[model samples]
Target: MIKLELIVQVHQLKKQGFKVAAIARKCNLSRTTVYEYLEMDFEEACRWVNELRTREKKLDPYKNQILSWLKEHPDLSASQVSDWLEERCSFTNVGDSTVRSYVRELRELYHIPKTISFRSYEALEELPKGKQTQVDFGEKKVRTTKNKWKKLYVIAFVLSHSRYKYAEWQEHPFTTRDVIRSHENAFEYFGGVTEEIVYDQDKLMIVSENGGDIIYTEEFQAYKQQRGFSVYLCRAADPESKGKIENVVKFIKNNFAKNRVFHQIESWNEQCLAWLDRKGNYQVHNTIKKRPIEVFTLEKLHLREVSYPLSFESNHGSSITRTVHKDNIIKYKSNRYSVPLGTYKPHGDNTVYIRIEQEKLIIQKTPEGVTVATHPLSTGVGQLIKNSDHTRDKSKGIKAYMDTVKESFDNSEEIELFLQEIHKRYPRYIRDQLQIIQRSLRDYGPFVEQALDTCINQRLWSANDLHDVSIHLAKLSEKEIPAVLRDIPLTEASSELIKEKASVRELDGYLRILGGA
Candidate 1:
């Protein structure tokens, strides 16, 4: 028997001019089942569904036993019921769906509603000032100025002691580089770095966790070493360990990003910062019973001072060497600024000299000091500031590079249309978008084709959307998502760095606590 919801969906798709096979694929139903449902009218389909529900189910023999179990454990799930049946009665040959359907019928007939079990939690003791900060990521779809929906990603940071929050938004899924940049921005906003930072088991930072041994990604490992902060990764399935940022992530989505019209990434972030100033930080916190900004003022004293490399100063500074990434870009102040094409060498040194002078970022070739690129520095996080000319090869030109990217896909015409839409949306950064698509093809391979179809059908015109769809498809197929990895060893000092520190109290405070002062 088919679900009434599936029957209704079949009829709706048929009205929408979808072919039978396409409907089958969309609904994950067999052609025969679809045909059987398509032959019935709405009333006939309702009758058929009701008749099937009343029919004797395979687990009807143990109906009373299941009901008694539900009475004892009101939060028991269908899957658990099926498992109990197999274990207690040695039941076999019944499909999971069959058991699920029968359990639903029993619940409805007996008026036994499923109850949700809530986990009990205790309020943890507050951390000492500047002891730790928690980080988390969140994404939401918001209405653009054109009234179309666009997805935005945000990384949130919350100081564990004061809950002083800082969040940054982007138009794309964050890479490891983006995560590092956000960390820098968070530290700058808080005026200093904490002794330790807590994080979830995010792939951007962590590569794998075997037993208690944690393996961080190569880029994150380098950043961790440079920043001199300890990292405490929460165990898998335990987000409550770092519940501060989890609540902050929800607070950002609900209070700021919710119902907000996104004009552009830069402006959206500007609005978020303004919101933080007025409402998010200024308002009284429910748990701490004080304003975050006020608590942060005192907590700021205990924080470690921000450090920078001796090679360069940030404000109107002398040049410092920065490694050019494979995408012909270098990081400056949490944003990626572009360099000329072919600057990144696969087999040789790819370092370039960068400096800030009079509010402009200058990129020059090393030793010779020949200028390669220059741009006004960006104030936003995760922005890709590119010069169109820098992405163009003198011989091939931009059009030829676009064609080369499109030809790499199976459906060149569709890919061309998608690329053209991306060009229209992001005229200045079309080359970077195209390079992202090329990388997706190299990484996701054949899955990129399906992802393209999804993007085109849904009218998603960004490379990030295409990349996200490809990852979704890859996960659905149980295939491993490809990523860059290195065999960097975790040193003993870093491993031991995450141990919790004991808070010390003054003798005067102890005397007062004992009422003997």
Candidate 2:
């Protein structure tokens, strides 16, 4: 194309009586095409030359803008720039082909100047089994209930030798808490530990950047110090250093998350785990020729035992605004948790640290780290509470029951009565039921009385219901007691009621006779 353009220019010069050899020397075209153009009529020659190069000149305007953008943002390539221009400015004259050609031309002109430097990655000569693992976050497209598309982040890990992969959807924000929790979960799932973990330099881990120095986040540094696991971070913007984990991320997303239908993030994660065990690890890898599970079994012996006792505190270090409601409940994550009255502003913001474990929230004073309160998982939008000591105490009723037992009967007699009563009441083995009742007594305190009352009223013994009700009582505030007790109708039954009812299990039968259940 360049030679043809030069030939036309040289031939035009020759028509003005310049020597063909001189034209060739100046324009860098061969003498042959230049002579042909010179022999042709001006109209025919111009038409032939334009046919060869007209499209390029036609897109010159749009191509210039694309070149300018690429110069401004060197990281952006021609196609990306073309898409941007197409959306924002509707650069009508340039197509993708033209943009590509212009980029090629620019690169040729400034080849040496625009070259990017990359550090060569060395292949691992031999990795001891379970000696190292690599971690990364992979994104997959998921649809919301409204059918809108969103990217879900999954944490991906790969064992160095076995190439065994583990992945789970990260339902929470990518925070230091999330990172630590993911590590714990992965370790538990793998049933072992690796000596070293290679990680991306996530912001949660790298707190600050000072030239070539990276300051680790306080939470991450604490974890490393306590756990005794060596940390290796990939160089900034270099993902290939952790290529095994990167490939695991791609494989899990494509094979597991992409193929499944899920209603919740947790459900998707669980499905991925099951799929990894059954379909992914069980199948022979195309390159490795052995099943991942088989390879992992061989490598498991090489993994080091977890070096230190595992104990973790929540990284609740966040700037939170305490929102107070009229009901004295502070809202978090669409559910209501209680705070001391007048400590928070109505419709205003105050900072607090909320340490979450599973679904439980432990609200704490920010600077002091003193536990202000703990809340069970909330059911709905609000809670009603009174200011009291933050400690959860449920021993009052149990102590009262023990005192009554002690006072009313001989020690041996009371023990025999309790055992015989429990054995007679339960259809299954009594020991499990006794343990369940004991746990409920500890958790529910006096509210265990209500659970007992529920059992007595229904003439049924249910350990599961006792446990569930105790948990429910732990979540309820003093204000909710009146309403809950009223709903259960437990306190006011008379001897007449007992005589009329015959048995607690018959209450439902009685209700059924009255067309209620």
> Which candidate comes out best when scored by lDDT?
1
- Estimate, for each residue in 1-517, the C-alpha lDDT of model 2 and write its tens digit: 5645655676578668888776775676678856776777657766776786555464565655756766777777667867887797876566788777667776666551344667876656658787899998877776666655556778888888888888878544455556777777788677778889998877667755556576777767888777678878788788888888888888888877763555787677778888899987888877678898999988887776654435543433243335344555565655667765555543233445666768777776663477667777665655543334322333454445444433422344533444456657762345466567667666676776665555555654556676787677667766678887767644456645766744356567878888985
lDDT of each: 0.84, 0.67
Count clashes in each candidate, considering only residues at least 3 apart in sequence or on different chains: 0, 5
The TM-score values for the models, in the order shown, are 0.46, 0.44
Residue 30, model 2: lDDT of: 71
**Largest TM-score belongs to which candidate?**
1
Looking at candidate 1, the ten consecutive residues that score lowest on lDDT are 310-319
Off by over 4 Å in 2: 1-122, 144-146, 209-214, 307-517
lDDT of 2: 0.67
lDDT of 1 by residue, 404-444 (tens): 88778888789889988998898668778988888888889
| Model 2 residue 299 lDDT score | 87
- lDDT of residue 41 for candidate 2: 69
User: Can you give the lDDT of residue 505 in candidate 2?
Assistant: 65
